[model samples]
Target: MEPDGDIEIFLVASPGLESVLCEEALARGFRDPTVIKGGVTIRGGWPEVWRANLELRGASRILARVAEFRAFHLAQLDKRARKVDWGAILRPDVPVRVEAACKGSRIYHAGAAAQRIETAIREELGAPISDDAEVQVKVRIDDDLCTISVDTSGESLHKRNHKEAVNKAPIRETLASLFLRRCGYDGGEPVVDPMCGSGTFVIEAAEIAAGLNPGRSRRFAFELLAGFDEAAWAAMRGAGGEGVDPAQITFRFYGSDRDAGAIAMSRANAERAGIAGLTEFRQHSISDLVPPDGPPGLVICNPPYGNRVGDKNSLYPLYGAFGRTLLSRFAGWRVGMVTSERGLAAATGLPFAPPTAPISHGGVRIMLFTTEALA
Candidate 1:
């Protein structure tokens, strides 16, 4: 596997948002992005993989499929894994960890398969294998074929490395970006999140409107890989920040919550993300929520699902008031609400479209209910 040769790049997306991720990949000029069960796959060299990690907002992480071979049993897997040109990808000086998964294959034991690959890499490639290593080689054995891929993004793209504070049940930044896209946001208008916890939607929107790359502040595992060209990577990274000028921006993203602590956390998070000037966070209840001055844009929120024990009915009044406020004041603005309960969404009475497929977040299944611009 040559580093400059075309290879398979997979952009992992949260489940149920695969198509949304495909839209982003297509918009970003990735070639032939076909949506798979868990992510979008495109063919590219190491440079494309870096751009995917750096510019793509909805991708959870980028995986570079380095090698693949047919292996029926443990011995064959060991032989093929050892024959892989690991020197082209993995650095001998940098330690790596091997993780394996098997499905409908002769080599069913994941631990045993991982051990075989680990031994192969360690003995043949001269790279150290550690249980706690920053670089990882993923081995997927499915239906008698073994695929080896590298997780190019060290930390998940959601961990922008700047947000230091978080409120409970916060939406991941990647997920929030997709939800905003689903709401027809094109970075040209404002967004308001009434029950914004940690200000995920607002901060994400502000960054998007300003044309900032989501991975700008974070380091990636690709930087440690063998054959990494620091100068080339720096040029690629520099070109991405050539986005919309903040001075030409006319809209702002807003967030408000009843808890003052949440407001403070959102402000701090925005400041740390380099998006504070374009975003506003306030302490106010849902009943007091109002649209920001400017053209109506989007009203998206991930409110409490009331899934806690004996807490379902307690949130009805809150949802109802939130709905009434939107219908009464936010004319011409679209709404995208995230919740697990259909009844809770209905409580808003905001004329949402039929809910889409359930999206799993933090082990809980939620759906995004969208509406056209309010009448």
Candidate 2:
């Protein structure tokens, strides 16, 4: 908040997938990312915040810590908050929404805490406070200490602005990217999602292979912050040069579903993502799914579970057929799947190794079940 050189940057992950997100952040060249309950925290300045929002595919959102202080009471909090250099990070013209959480703090009421900060910002910084604003300032009071952070990503990173059509219960692209990484996918080979609802897995795989930034097509909240340098941001986005050319991408991504509407959605999404040239979508059932005309790669999907779709009792045979089809035709290809029930995954009999930590999606918990190359 005082325009200090470096600030704490937290990359929020899906509730139970912090470890996987940490792995991705480390692999993406973030230094010594430490995993916490909800996210991975690192130390960096505005540049790192921008890069994280732009490049980290697994992060649901990025939060930049602006200030921290110990305040046992609401009046003391208001006094300290008024002293923060809100002008350094926030623009007077752009409105902000304040959200507060209290835990083990003398100031036990979250509403009062948020009101104090809101009044401080409104009176001292001259910024309007609104209930619905793209810029969010979060106040966390825990153990008598208050931490203020700004949400740098306006919309969730999963909303790449690429997919307009979606399935009833679809896997988010951010989670799909992490699941792909957990399956040891590094953009070196083909990827197929047999139950592709809206082409999330296939599109994410294509983007990874092409070395495209997930936030390439979208805007972020950081752009609305004070002292945002547009030229510098443009240079940063182009620093690594453009993505791998579609022509150079020899490997193809395939997605198919029994529903023709899903196939159309996938095709449209792929086209919007500018990867349709290197992707193929078809309307076909799982029984017709087979490896593309190339080297074996990874087969990953988020199949229906009882909590999201059809009845639990009716899904076992679907899982069985999916497993049988893979066993019969997809030797040497690795598999990754997301399902809520262990029994349904067991029905596949795919010999998946231990599953990753359960991930929170929609409302229920699901795990990414994976296996090495099929024997």
Candidate 3:
């Protein structure tokens, strides 16, 4: 990997959700992404890598190409690692952490492999290696081919630098954003989360509407690299806030939850995201989801699936009652609901056509049901 024009990026996603990440990458202008078991790999320039890091709500981390070589043993790995251009990526003063893993390869000793790479980086590049360092260099050896990548995202994208308050089983920002995109949210119409827990969807929606980049408030490891371009990054940060005013947006975002504590957390999270005024929170139940006084909009909800003890039988009736309420009152509104259990979704019985597609939510296999306005 010798400073080629385009960089190879690995877009990591939730388990069994590689296809969804691929679809999202394609939608975001990634060309011919290769879908692997747990992630999608794409080739792009530095700008694309930065934009993907900032805009891609589904990716766990965006890795950049540092180097690659073919090594059959430890000696060969050491020789090849020493000959590469480390000055291009790592400064001699900046400390780094080296992580290595081997799979289906002759070199099966992960600890020894990591030690070799760390020694090479330290001695050859003069870069300090530390245990608690933020900069990480990853080495993967598979089938006698060794690949090296740097973790561009220091912290996971889900830690959006906000959300000081959270509730039990809170929805991840990436999953919530993906579900919203799947529900066809174009930042044009009103939205609601009847069972909104911490207002993840509502805040993401407001950010999308206000043209705020999801990654603007956070920092990445790439920003600390040797040749990091500060001017280019500033331009990229400024690009997200164009042509949108939250005040003029006609869409009225709302959230409601049975737990008052959840509402308080949701409000606080919204305020931290700077979209508190753009969204409304209320302590209410599913039965109170009357159609908005304005236009009929999408109602996206990630209700509990009763996965704990004593939760199954007790929560089923809540699902049934929610279904009855939607059928009786929300006749002309579009409904998008996510739940881990198919039985709980089937309990809705809102006459949905079928799931658009199933997505992974919080380590469980979940399906989504969408229904158009009732006739």
Candidate 4:
């Protein structure tokens, strides 16, 4: 088991947007962040873990590597799991849930391995075990090396704790932020989402422009950890560059949806996010999408695809209408559209430069089709 002073923190990113997340971590001044296969790893202690959960918009969840050891079999795993100083990281008063996974390990039964760790924490540390515990201990046994990590961010970071209303096929806030970054958005200009499902892009743009921390409104599992200092955490949360003044914001984000319910949901979500002043939502169809009266900005949306929503032939007309509206009316505005089918993206004839690597959304592989600034 490693000392609690310098722990390894892993930032879980969506599969295709690892590079974008790495860029975000680097820009945020995480120490020695190395992009790994599934996520980004950084060396830090409790403060760094808390900060990562509070500040990072692209990370889906944060994991703190608490301990690792070699265990060839279930008996060895039980012996070593008992030796870990769980008291150093987990509070006895707070209940925890233990989850485990194994790959190429002699201790092939993940449930059995998890049971050993759970019993150790219960007996050795006197911590209660519950299936619905807010704090989670994740044990991974891969190739005979058993690593224990704690899920510092509970309920995933995308919930953001503000969006109460969602339409069908809502985009996660983490993915929305990454997609915005991929579109070269720097929080400088206006953004418009023609098919805003629940105002995710518009609200995310507003929040970024306002310099609001994505995790400000949420609670984390780390608060229940052993070494948590309430005063210190409060200070850290308060000591930061405050968000932009709503009055000072010059460009407002816009979203329009044909469904009035979606438009209502967007408005409600923006208000709850405290960025309502920086956003505008209207009930309008794609053919009615018009650029706001300002300098050009990125126009982005995650529209329905054939795989999930409707028949391909029916959606082509929607895509075509969307493209024609953008090309004919939104000159000088760049465009980014997310869809699972290339043919649907092509039907728009919007001159997309190239599609990004596929991203899994709702069991469908989707790609972002982007175009250069419209001529």
lDDT of each: 0.92, 0.91, 0.81, 0.91
Q: 3 or 4: which has the higher TM-score?
A: 4
Pitting candidate 2 against candidate 3, the one with the higher lDDT is 2
lDDT of 4: 0.91
Q: Write the per-residue lDDT of candidate 1 for residues 39-65, one digit (tens) a residue.
A: 999988899998999999999999999
Off by over 4 Å in 2: 1-4, 308-310
TM-score of each predicted structure versus truth: 0.98, 0.97, 0.92, 0.97
- Name the lDDT value of residue 215 in candidate 4: 90
lDDT of 3: 0.81
Candidate 1 residues lying further than 4 Å off, grouped into runs, are 1-3
RMSD of each: 1.0, 1.5, 2.3, 1.6
Candidate 4 lDDT over residue span 243-298, tens digit each: 87888888899999999999999999999999988999999788887889989999
Q: Any runs in candidate 3 off by more than 4 Å, and if so which?
A: 1-4, 30-34, 353-363
Best-matching candidate per TM-score: 1
Q: Over the full model, what C-alpha lDDT does candidate 1 score relative to the true structure?
A: 0.92
Clash count, candidate 2: 0
